[model samples]
Target: MKYQDLKAGIRSHLEDAAEDFFMVGYFLRQISENALFTEDGYKSIWEFAKGEYGLSTSSASRFMAINARFSIDGGEHMAEKYIGMGVSKLQEMLGLPDEELEKVTQETTVREIRAMKKRQEAPRSFYGFPKTERPEGSLLTTPGCGDGKYDCFSCCRECAIRQEPRHCRTAPLGNPFPCTRVNNEEWKKNIAYSLYKDECQLLHPELAPVREGDKEPDPCCLNCTNKTCFNRCDVAKKKDEDEKKQSQEELRKQQREAEAKRPEPSDRDIKAFYDWAGIKTTDNITAEDLKKRYKNAGGGGGRGAALQDYTGSARGIRINHKKELTWVQIAKRIKEIQEAEKKKADFVERSNGAQKNVRDLIKQQEEKRRIEAEEKKAARAAAKLQAEAEEPGKPEIIDGDFREVEDEPMDDPAQEAAKTRDERQEPEPVLCDTCEHEGECAGKKTHENGCMGYEEKAQELEAEAEPNPEEYARFDVESILKKEKGYLDGGREADCPAKFIKEHKILVDALTLLLEKMDAEGGAED
Candidate 1:
């Protein structure tokens, strides 16, 4: 058939299918709404459709939704304009607005319609404010009210009224409007009061009372007359200023007490302390250097005594003394501590050296004793050998006959000859060297005797010496090409014979080239 005719026929069939889908959706809607499935001995429309027409639950739901969205004349018929569009395109267009539906045409694809719908429904800026900053219950976008107004404040008030049924604390029992009374203390304690105060400050800034020193009206100022008046108010402002001044004075008093309790040393005090302590000063004298000097002095005292002195009349030396000492007294204490530590360190060092000397003396004595024991053992062995060498043959009674048994010396010629022969012979190979049971084998006797593992290893070595038939079969180019050619010939009746033959020939050529490259590589290796 000609291509245009074929395309026309397919298009017509697609339009007919679209019409059938719409009618199906309309009929399913009617059946579901009326519970007409009960007449067919089914509990629900889903069961009836599944049993009679093989429609699944999800498919039935989609059909019902489509009918509800695109049906005309109370779902008696579908809109004729959507008949040519496929079911998938119509379903994608369902999310689009009524006005946007006009943009869809016969050429519009399902994916394009889906994208358009997504763009339309994408979340907008929350009422011209960031989503995080938007108030709870506030509309995401501006919505028209019954009176054709788009004021957010009014809408928020209405939303608040609907969500919270409580009346204001000062309002009459049945009053529906919000309480406008502003109390600064209440603003801190009550959420509704704070929100109302903020709303008034933001929306009606002109009505806020101004203070004397403020260049512009303070939006954060407390309201006194229910946001109705804008008179200059200074009583609250004056009281707040006085409280602030009092707090500052109290803070300064605390700082002074702390300073008096823990005073910092001046430059003169530091110099005097260092001089009395007999410590040299430099531009870069770190705490670490001081610590090293203290260690070298062998200082032995608690930290409190090293850094402080007692001024109490009852004490020659006080434990846990506070900072009652002057700089000179502190330096004197530090010098005494350093001298005591130095003496202690010196005594400890001398004691350690004496202990080391004693240990060395003990080690030398043990070595002398050990040498004497070894020498005695060697002398005894030599005496035994000499006695054996001097001894003659002794007669022994054996089996009713007198026999002579000769004693062998440590340096016997016969034993020496046997040792020489052993040294001259080459070592035997380990029986388990090539055995599979190597580590677990009993011994050389087991390996040499009737071990099946040894036999198997020998056989494996022999097999390795010969070429593998399976390996040759795997790389046999002629056999592989013949098998592939047979497959191509067999499939020729199912597909175009010429096309099959061409593809088979191309595969054969690729295989041949691969084999030739492999042969070249092998030859280079050889």
Candidate 2:
């Protein structure tokens, strides 16, 4: 047939099929799935047909094609090249009650879909080809509330509200992010607050910060079909979850790297920790005590030790002897061994205990620290008074004319606090700590990034509270140019939102990771 004639037939078929709603949807979905012209584009096959070939992909048929359609040509399918096989059959084969389908189709409640299934066997009397009986030993196939009646009007999805998949927390047995509406129910936007507050959640991967209560947007509460709308929303809850997980993983990795780089514990902290454990020094502690200290220090398990080399975990009991002992038996043995050890150690410790009561010793140490702290405070006060007395007479060492700090203004408390915090946060950069230059750590040949003379740099910093106008302007221009390159004024089309993007990314990443582990990264999808 000519393309124009074919298009007419399809459009006519669709118009005629409107009387039968099932056929209309069947036509729409088939056209949607298989009819697009380009491999990648928003246009559907039906849309492509209308545009490119001047063809129409819609259908008008004498039969609803709800279950099965027989063709006159033997072993022949419908005239059009067939790509999809099960859709029509699957719909007809579905044994869901009319009431249930109606509820699912129009009301948007997906709870009923949970128990009902698409792949399972149909009831014996369901109207379809090659009907089979329910299993002989089956418990029951009781119909849900008002499940028997099926009306043609409310069967198609267009008659009802639109719900995005991410809007509802509950998805059906195998499906993700389906509607949570009910059957023949009044279409109230808000039901029980619980429906939204607890049940409806977004599906994004943004990091959610720790908060005392629900920190998600309250405005998200009222307007919902409870449809999953992760794709459209910028700040989906799932995206927050994903971001947090990613940030946590990054933090863990960064911490691992940092810990690897970190210098070993200082002598003071190590000694303090050992003392707190009631050990004289870390070197004096036993392997078991070391294990305890490691646990307290937030360490976990590793290999190379024998299975029994380690002490019993916090929740386990030690076995004094090599035997198959029950937990109770092990506990009893441990207690007995511990009591014996205590008795043996007591003899030596009791003599030492009299010489210096542990508590009294600690108290004496604390008192000495307090006295030292008071002395330091008094010395600081005396020095401040002397500095004030000498302030008037001395020729200032700080050269006022070559001021590194601004001469115009004194500091604001708020600004000073902010500056102090910023200073604390900045990672120390690679700079030469030593320089012989006079004015600043400037234009000099040195091994360390020419950043030597930090003391000179410090002096310059003290002088220059306000930057030179021309210098600041030049720096600002470069920063703005770099930012412009990173993004378009508007966002990119392909740059899927992090939330929906994360959903797809996580799924694809999981698939890739799984494939790699399975040694099937290059293999075809199953």
Candidate 3:
């Protein structure tokens, strides 16, 4: 197939590739520590066997293969060929909407990624590495070329052409091998020179400098790929090209307009660092993207507001070409974040409602994560889809292409949500005044594998404690009444411990029952 077609296929396959990585990476990550120890997400078959399903490291490696090979048809390894074509770290190249996050599974967390990075169980025999780290094919020659021995004669001359633009002339035949190579008189030559000579570059060979299934290096680099180099540029020629292209893109246009709308960072107050993506990076993220990620985290799909989000700006952020963000200024910014976080903590401590809302969200998030992990585990095991879930095989579409509109304002909606979750109107868990038992009345399993003895425990604990459980329940009502009024009248403080508060309802209930019995007796006499 043609190279262009292969490139297009690579792009399409990447959508599948990321999911595959998540699947394989997650499984590899899981068995590393306590996977077998947790029965919750394990297969029911594994559970009944009561075995660890223990495997040696080599055997553990096969787990990813087993899952990757999963299919309704059973043994079809569908991902084999497309994975053979090679995947790209193109996901890293794209600028994220500041307001967005992918619909991530539990496997996407940093902790899981940390485990996967230790070793990749990639079967070198099947799929190739995702990042070839380059794009160009052939000798990577250019239209305007020169040749020299000490350095690439091609580069020496390009440097000449750049430094002396008047001296260079366009090749009618279109430049020879490595035609696209820029003249960098100072920058060191790459591996192309240390190994293959003019036979490749001078001759313009058809085969990629790879032979007999050997991996090929990408020619797409800082100088060769003129589009990305900016301040980190080594040569004058590529730098000029980088800036010229940057001004034209529609993305930059929106960026410039949006940045203009917000107050520009003062040189003193708003810190700037080297752009890690090279100079082509505008050091800007769209307000639209951040909101999208935030919404995704909330399990919603809606276009983010066009308003500004100053949350975590990566612009002026210095990261390597690998996009590894490492800079002192970013660290400084993180400290500022910590301080701001402290203020939020203080506010939460002051406001009961805020703390409760945060707690509810945490509970909801944990519940969502538990359900997600269970589904993924089921998918890996090639089990039938769970009836409780929508299914685990949905395609991941994270881009802003699909978004629903919400008419409500963010502030009002947030307030309403906070009130709903944090309002203190609901009753707390019921405790039996008749017992000192923890946990729901033993109708529910303690997960100890026996018939629940909830009533027995309640009565036993009640027999041990002072005051009848029935009287304790009534005391709670009066205590709560006095305590609530104390906030207004400032007369007496009702010291009701959490233990008593919980146990009180049982007493009140019992007293009411006794009174009802006495009334029944009176009615019978009449």
Candidate 4:
């Protein structure tokens, strides 16, 4: 077959096989072992996984490793040993040989397998030595085999730990190799030293450096629980002393900065302090003196003390209090203050509500009194109008018909008597009776005067007469009494005795009738 046809067919088969994890692992093993993708211009399996198959390098590598361990001689089908096992279980058991893994059951978990493996890999002796040689693909890398002569070069120059000598790990843990300097020249000078001391002393103590007096010295400082050698080692002791001195210097520097930032005491604070000490002073006291007095009195000794003392004295008061706040305590204090403010606000609101209620009640009572007063006034007015309407002899129709006419001067008795008889007798129709101004004036000579023009007077009399049942019921009793008195005192003005006698007889009859009615009503009541 042509190379292109073969390649296409293989790609097609790979696409199908890559669907499952184990199948993909099988394909990966085949592709990597034969370097099949190299012909397609891919450099390695990682390139093939990324460029062609679209798989991550980590995922592809993991599949390939699993295929090698789970399959029989890297076969297409997974071995019966771990067919139903989880991927993680298989990864953990990968260190075991195929024969040993085949004995494991599907019921076994990954954690149990890992624990079993850890136990198997544990040191068998009490000297903390590994049960086996280091694994081929270990993560740990000990440069120059922990030799002190190894040159750190550019890597160490940029290292923060190297810049700060206090951060060096060897100061506390101690060096592993015989060479004491920054380089491993002492181990290189003796070829046997390099070969023997290649491993950590804790694991293989036979290769450790020899001491003068002790038959068997400690392999590593970390293994020594007593730590008695910390004082004996000159390097550890000197580093410890340097660290303590540096820490003290740093503490002093911080204190100096804080003291510089501290504010000067105010005038009130100065006066209060002087007063408390029973010393007469004023606001002119120097800041230096105040600070001295504050410090002597234990100022800045603890939190919240820079502003005031514990005894509620305002002596050492400062602008800012040196108090450290924790969130829990701040929240608790804030809640307490909020509750107090809420209580105060509620009290004010309730007081205002009560006042408003009282004002509203008073307003309602005043309105009620006003309404009652208005009702009473209206009732009294209505009663007075009713009494006026019921009064007898009250004028209803005053169209001037009942008014006395003005008399003309009369020296002759016969002419006066004729005029009086005409006036006192029944009304006579005038020759100009049809005149529009007729009856406007009460005088009999209205015709001769062409009728006085009194239109408004006529209208008022008509309006007043319209509301009553008896519009013309007025007796004009006062005019009749005046007439009688005039007749008794100066005789008749016109000498009409019959008319005067008739009026006297009418008055006597009316009084007798009124008396009889009153007597009858009184008897009925009794």
Ranking the candidates on lDDT from highest down gives 1, 4, 2, 3
Q: Estimate the lDDT of model 4.
A: 0.49
Candidate 3 per-residue lDDT over residues 154-258, each given as its tens digit: 222222223222111233435433333434333335424433322222122111232233242212233232233322233335555666787667677886676
Q: Give the alpha carbon lDDT tens digit for every residue of 1-526 in model 2.
A: 3334433545675566433333333443344435433443534444454464354332222122331232224122332322232334324324444443443442233344544544335432222222222456867442211232322111212222211222233235465443334221332334433343223322110111212242322223223345453322333445666867999999989866865664443323332332333442113333454445433233212343122122334433222212222234433443444444444455335434633574586578668766766776677679889989888675767755773765445378756655666779853333332454432343344423344455565675455333232332333334333433222221123232356444444544554454454344334332
lDDT of 1: 0.51
Q: Give the top-scoring candidate (lDDT).
A: 1
The alpha-carbon lDDT assigned to residue 481 of candidate 4 equals: 44
Q: Per-prediction RMSD in angstroms?
A: 43.3, 42.6, 49.7, 33.6
Off by over 4 Å in 3: 1-167, 170-200, 203-251, 259-526
> How would you encode candidate 1's per-residue C-alpha lDDT over 91-206 as one tens digit per residue?
77765656678898889999898778567633322122111233578665433322223322222222311222223323454655442322233433443444343335423333
Provide TM-scores for the models.
0.22, 0.20, 0.14, 0.23
Off by over 4 Å in 4: 1-19, 97-103, 121-526
* Model 3 lowest lDDT segment of ten: 123-132
Cα deviation at 408, candidate 1, in Å, is 99
- Model 1 worst lDDT window (10 residues): 310-319
